[model samples]
Target: MNILRSPPVPFTDQASVSERRSNLLDASTISPAGFAWLMLGISVSMMLCGSVTFFIGFMLMPWVIGLLMVFYVAGIVSAISLLGRSIICNALAPPSPRKHIPDNCFFCSSLGFDN
Candidate 1:
C-alpha cells in the first residue's frame, strides 16, 4: 500500500566523487568520540537493566524470568554489535550493496587494488 508518494528522480553518476561520497556513509561523517560514548552508554544501561531484572527475579524466585532476562540481555547486546558493524561497513570503502561503483574507487584502492 502506498500513500503520499513523491515522484522518483533519475539516478545520475556524473556527480563528482566528493558529492557521491556524501550520499554514502563514509568515515568523514562520524565522530569516533561520539561512537565510543554511545557504545559505552548502551553497555552501561544494558548492564544496569539486566542486573536489576535478575535481582528482581531472584527475589521473586521465578526461574523463568531470570532466563528471560538473560536472553533479553543477549539479544540487545547482539543487536548493538550488529548495528555497529553495519555502520562501520557503511564507512568502509566499497560500501555495501551498491552497483556500478568504479573499480578504482577508494574502497578498492585502500584494499591495495591497482590498475
Candidate 2:
C-alpha cells in the first residue's frame, strides 16, 4: 500500500471543488474526526519526508523546504476551515417562511394548483 497516498477522495476528480466539498460533508463521508485524522497523517508524512531528504543530503534546497512548509501549513488551515463549514445543501436546506411562500408554481409545489 502506498503510505504517501492522500486521504481517499470522497469524490471524483472530475467534480468541482464545491461538489467535492459537498461530497465530503455528506453522511456517507462524515466521520467525527476524519479530517483531523487525515490532516495528522499528511503532516506527519510531510515532516518525515522533509527530514529524510534534508538529512540524506539530497539535492533538496533549504528554500524549497521552507516553501513546502508554508504550503503545508496553509493546506492544513484551509482543510480545517472546510471541515468547519455547515453541511447543509440547497436541496436539503431547512424550511423557512420564504420556502413555503410559493415563488414558482412548477418548483414550489408538487400538487397541481387549481388556479
Candidate 3:
C-alpha cells in the first residue's frame, strides 16, 4: 500500500545515547580562562557606562541648579510685585465715609439720653 518508500530510522540504546549527550556537553563546557575573560569584559563595560553617566550628570548639575534658582527668584519677585500693587491700591483709594450725629438729635432725645 506504500506509494513512496521512506528511509529507515536508526535505533540507539539508552546507555549509548546518554554517553553521547554527556560527551557533547563536556566538549561545549567553558574553560576557566574563558570564564575569567567573560567576567573581565562585563566589568569593563559596566565601568565605562558608569563613568559616562557620572560625567553627564556632573555636566548638567549647574544647569539644573540654575533653573531651580530662576524659578525661586521669579516666585519671590511675583509675590513682592503683588504686595506692592495691593499697598498702592489701598493708599490711592478714597476713605470710607463716617456717620455723623447732630448735637440735638431727636432719636437720642426720644431715648431719654442727653447729648
RMSD of each: 34.6, 31.5, 12.9
TM-score of each: 0.33, 0.27, 0.60
**Model 3: residues >4 Å from true position, as ranges?**
1-16, 95-115
Worst 10 residues of 1 by lDDT: 1-10
Candidate 3, residues 54-108: lDDT per residue as tens digits?
A: 9999999999999999999999999999999999999999998999888689889
Error of 3 at 48 (Å): 0.3
Best model number under lDDT: 3
lDDT of 1 by residue, 1-95 (tens): 01123323338867676666654534334466766777888899999999999998788876777889999999999999999998998788584
- Stretches of candidate 1 above 4 Å error? 1-14, 25-29, 62-115
- Largest TM-score belongs to which candidate? 3
Predictions in order: lDDT: 0.73, 0.67, 0.79
On residues 1-115, what C-alpha lDDT tens digit does candidate 2 reach at each position?
Answer: 1223344484455778887766445535535477677788889999999998887766557778999999999999998877666444544777666545545577445675534
Q: What residue pairs clash in candidate 2, if any at all?
A: none
What does the lDDT come to for candidate 2?
0.67
| Models ranked on lDDT | 3, 1, 2
